[model samples]
Target: MFGEYSFNNSQPASAGGHPGPGAGPAPGNLPPQSPGFVGRERELAHLGHLLPDRRLITLTGVGGVGKTRLALRAAAASGPERPDGVWWVELSPLRDPGLLTATVAHTVGLADHSARSLDEELCAWMADKKLLLVLDTCEHLIAACRHLVGELLQSAPDLTVLTTSREPLGSPGEQLVEVRPLPFEGPDSDALALFRRRAVAASPPAAAAFDDPGRATIAAEVCRRLDGIPLALELAGARLRSWTLEQMAQRLGARFDVLADSDDALLPRHRTMRTAIGWSHELCEPVERLLWARLSVFTGDFDVAAARAVCAGGPLPASRVERVLAGLVAKSVVRRTEERGAGIRYRMLDTIREYGHDWLTELGEVRTVADRHAHWYLALAQAADRGWMGPGQVDWYRRMTAEHPQLRTALEQLLKCEPAAAQEMAGALWFFWFACGHVHEGRGFLERSLRSGPRTGTGYTQALWALGLTALLQGDMDAARGLGEECTRSADRLADPERELRAAYLHAVAVMMPGDSVRALTLAGPRARAGHGGRSSGPGWLLCRLATGFALCDLERFEEAAEEARGLREACAELGERWLRAYADYILAMSALGLGHHGEAARHVRAMLSNKRLLGDRFGIALGLDLLAAAVAGLGDGELAARLLGTGHAWWRTVGRPQMGGSPALTALRDEGERRARAAIGDAAYETAFLGGTAAATG
Candidate 1:
């Protein structure tokens, strides 16, 4: 979901590349390949043969049997054949099936701007593209995967899906490719090659000893004892740096024997895999084991700050976590990698994470660690909220987006044990949810927390205010009004002017959205005045001013609206906040258009568009495009205006909203722009231009 789009004649540098106009560099979403990929030539060749004929291929095997690696290799090898390239969607971080469609849509670069369902948008986007979509780690969400894959293959004839799971997806047309463990018997076996490769990298001394036939026999026995599973071999090989091959082999054999006796219920391969991980765990120092258990709380990759905050205290000191983490990485128990623009992040493989989770449960520290993780993320959300109106707004957005999975995990845990904390945390993340087009997910959290939490205090008031705003954006006026009224009552009882002002702003926006300008003005005017009387000067106060400008414009008070908008724009400029300024620009642009200042209106619209683009605010961008098209229409470029309208409509669909609420004037302007453009160009020509614009937006 996060990469640059380019046009390239040669092979793309990235994995998933979608074909663009004129055969530029393709757009793709494949993750980078793992380092030191040893073998799988036969599997790759088999995949190459199957892919051309099969639309859906499932690489099924036990955990750590190299299914994912084989899939990645096959997809990359087949990239040039498919003009749309390959897309990789990692499902390990996903917990809810409801988010599957949206996640896939985002990965494929489909913005949910239209009011259409995510599935509709995805199907439309992929209908003409020839690509491979790799769904990784699907066993946990097999049912969702089956349904989604079935829908996708039915809708897109040219699209191919490659999935890696412990079992088949069970969807129709799914070709099963059962991945077996690398062979340890032959002299030139892949398992031996992988073991030697890892051993030499882990220790130069081990590399020297491997040259001897005696040592080679020991290494072969070690591989055989571990059943030749790539993950097991690598973990075993990591110990060669500290222990002799014979020693590691003896320890692994003992551990596996103990595990086999203890858990005969598990499948043989599963028992082997868990035994290898448990052997690795036993070799770790006490502090290392403790850190591993604590680190299991994270759902995805984490940084040192997260590690220190969540995994420290209780045998693992905060100051020593970094060193212990490095040790774990060296031992192949944890993986360390550098994420683009995010510096270094650490992750444990799914199998390893499960082992750690089991240990954590045995230790009875699940609640304690979960609470710490929630608290840290709550602080992070609050910080991001504070920074949203400053220079770091975009950075904060990206950080919050990257941390979304972990935040969701935290919220789920908190909701059960500490509902009040859930309310506060969910309220704190409102800006991220709103700005990033996570309306459905955000509303769910807010509603659930509000229902379960106590109906008093600042946290509850904040939750109500946040929920009201989320509903307002979702066009649920009844829910918004109910929440707004509740927020008002709670704020008044608690004597919290800030929450009260926010409630007034919400109510005003709710009424203004439906064309009640006079009532909106009355509701917002007092709050705006109160906010400006040194009572509040944060985001809420700015929003109050924005609502006031919208009401004034809706009442046809152009001059007054322009003046208020300009003032708010200046204030936002001083505060280095673009979100509110974009709205202010929209109000100013509308006023200028109404007052017959075409050039001025165009400038304001362009400014709004630039700001929204900078913030990645798709909804704002759509509204700005509509206004810009209106300005273009007024300036006598109806053809271009029609195209822009089409582009704007496309973006609007991605946002799942037809138009921004609280401004009938703006809506009327959009309608007028469309009518004038169509009249000037004729319906046929207008339709052609509009479709062209939609194509351009999609590209």
Candidate 2:
């Protein structure tokens, strides 16, 4: 009824659709304003008054009291003051406190691939920005939320943190805003209006039933008995699909009276919300109830396929999931949203999800459901990995990014029981971690799986390769080499040639880390061609070719390297693979630079930067930006080169690395290019341009 701009009487959409904050992604996933915000005028104004001056404001309230909706709307309302934009980081689905900061980082588009602690990275990233970060549903992660919020406020002078929790986070300087339930009768806002709106939309045929003056009193009674909690009101509205307006009101009144008698321990409003939800659950069909319980295992949002895979079993077959899911949507138990690349996804409010989780625990199928959820995500990872070299490449990238939270959940879930399966999934997510800029998190999963799982097996060997890839990217040469060697030993012991070739390919990368391109070429060239029997395709094949091409360029065989890189680029093009294509562009750019084709070098370098940007690969951007600085410097654009160098410096700081991870050769080359730019532009002019670049980055 509120339409696209109204409040979601269903599930909130603050997860992926929120864009990056101004500091990261603009207006970062502050759930779409699809459902027009309803009747929070007083609370919104209060938030608006406090936002500009308060660094930390915690919206404390009972579940289902409209804290998240109010927080998002208020943040949106104060747009001019928050030039860096508002970032919504939903913490409701997280059970592990350890992942709190990482979740915040990921949600805000800080895909940091450094070894540094996430809190530190976040503080630095937000250090000079003016943005409002909304941490929704923090009751479960209160302590962690306090610590992180404190750290961020201390480090970022201009950052404002607005958190939603049942209790205050106890952080100093926090302003507590208790979001009360909507009023059923008021001049400014009335919960009865909300109920009537939703109820009318629920059953359009009997829509006038709610608006009839004779039934207005009964509708008001329904809103009052439900405590006017937005969630409860919406659930009541959905019941109109099955009952007349008067019947729904009478049922709610009876339900609340019984709930009040039974649960005096719960706050009155809490009891009302709980009783309303329980009544909804009781009214569901047995199969629908089961589906709701099983769906609690997912975090954020899930698609129809994912829901079926994780929730379907015994009595709930896959074929029936779609119909049951639609029923849930109709009931406002699950809200559907269209994600950019991922299709229609359904999400439950944290309050509703908690209710389902309680039922799941009651069903005594938590472990079973969790394992099924993990397996489903494992299969997703494997499929994405297999499709990495095909037309689905772009789709897989968006899909994996959309599903990253679930992948993390699966890795953690399996790590406690099936560590080998965990290793396999972590290894299978190579493209996500390696190319999609999750190298740091991939390292964590890979290292933990390796430590916990068996020392021998194909999955274990693949995990080694994946870990090696992360280590190399992180500039941990020793660990990369050790893992590569361990992979080789495991492959030899297992007699798996595919694993052996993968090990060789990674080992060649390790050899190249120390500026030994000659040895890298020697180790990778033959094995690379021989890898998977020289079929010369796929990630392994592409990686091997990429390595050889890099080694040739490092060896200053520019002509030969360019030829090889051209062929590799064409293959990546055919495969719709951007990650390796970016690298191929890198090789081409290097060759062009070496041959003094400055214009060609600039073109290739810019292409590489654009590709990395699409992948959200900040680490790759740091690398690519430096190359662009050089290409422009060689192209005789002194001022632009200086500015590029300064901008690249900020990115280098972000990744905690400088010019090819501190390699002396690359560092010296960068220095020479900087020197040339400085000489060409007068000292004063260069200094001004450089600062302008740094300002742009830091700003």
Candidate 3:
């Protein structure tokens, strides 16, 4: 059932630079703007006029004041002016302000896996781009938002930021556009228009009903009472699903009377919104209300499967969770979005989610539900670990990417409840953290969880290995070596030979990173050949074989390395395993170049690049591109080699390190390729070709 998995980290660009104009696995998560938007002509005009000229525009308003909706509408029209691509980042789901930079970078299509601070990574990512960034719901993270927006503006001259908050971020160059609720006054008022449109949407028959002058008057009165707030109108209109206009008016009038009596301090509009929301909660079927509260466990959009898993128990049966979720969507308590491949996903507006969170707290089920959520995600992480070797690897990558916010949430839950399990989950996601370009964030979780120190278990052993791999990628050789030693001790203490083999593989890579290929060979060879893992040593064995081939090539045993890499690659191909095969291809390519088989080297690098691209392995892609450049230079395409060299460097920047882990042996080869290219083409021709690739920027 494993379908060959692939990710579109970057669209294939021309031969010179990185991925083309189209980038990332997908465009930023800017949901389609709602079609129900009505009566903001004046605001839309002001925004359109100001957006192109202003660097930062803050849409200030109260909850339910339609700031978010207004921002979306404006952003839709503002795109033509800011066309690297307009990206929207929803901040409501983010609980930790520390993640702000990384979150924005991810949304903007930069899956950075570098060792650099995320602040540096994000700005470098945007340094050469022209795009409009919409940051929604900044009220909860005012200070962080202010700092980030200020820095981004300074770093990316062409970047414009649009923010929605109750208060302005007060950045020096920020412009304020207060989004008051739609005007409630005349019959033709924006509020009345919004109310009518939504009323018709809830019950199509309401369109005909509103044709009656008396009913139209009733609608206006309802809109006037709700004080022109779009959320209040939409909630009131949803009542048309079961009630007529007159009945909606009657129920809402009495509800507001009770809400008014209950609170004298609220603004009329703010009070109207609270009354409408409270009244909607009261109107829900018991199960639907329960589902609403429980689903608050999700930090972002979730699918039916997630809903059933986390929200089902006691009064809520697993079988009924989907039905109740549908009811919530129908009642406008939840929003649903369907995109190709992503499936139908649901999320609540920030205001609604907060209300549910408060109710979840009151029910004393918060911890219980949080535990269930953590367990569900833990199971998914384990499944990902098992499935990454198969065709389903691509899907798992996308699924985990979509669930990242929830994954972070689950990590927090597990850390509080059980540190060991948290560490295991972090380690289990090695493919995601390493192969999928989330290494920076993955390192954070691994380091945090490892603070509990070494544990003697398979999961903990792998976690240590995973951390070592990340350290190596970030060019932190000392940390990587330390982690490798720690992994070896833990595995030996546990009496797990396969685990020991795995540790050996890590130690080998760490040792080789700085050009000590001989030491790497010495460390990994004994464990690999001792037959410690036997039939079960498939993974650890493959890793050691891959490391051995790498060391052999570094040692210039060209013919031996080629034979070893070729045999291992064919074996992996037969088993449908691509990760090790990709590295094997790298080894064969390097060996071919060393043995003076330039065309053979090019073919091997091409095979390696194919696999790396499929898995979205940016680091692998970087390595492959560099070798490909060397091969191309040998094959007499000096200009192309120059371009490839520049493009490979761009990809390496995204990895936060130079290619080949900065090993002296590898760097020598890289230098040779550049030298050949400059010699073959004039220095002037090579520089021009290289600059063309660099100017295209990192994907």
lDDT of 1 at 625: 81
Residues 33-151, model 2: lDDT tens digits? 74635788888888878998888999888888888888878877876676666778878667788778777776655656666677888898889878788898888888899999999
Model 3 lDDT, residue 429, Cα? 90
Top lDDT model = 3
Give candidate 1's whole-model lDDT: 0.79
List candidate 1 segments past 4 Å from native.
1-25, 77-86, 109-131, 152-159, 211-214, 253-263, 526-528, 531-536, 660-667, 676-685
Better of 1 and 3 by lDDT: 3
Candidate 3 residues 153-262, lDDT tens each?
98998999999998899899889998988898876888888888887888899887778887889888898888888988888888888898888889888977776667
Model 3 clashing residue pairs (backbone)? 3-391, 5-394
TM-score of 1: 0.90
Worst lDDT 10-window in candidate 3: 1-10
lDDT for predicted candidate 3 compared with the true structure: 0.80
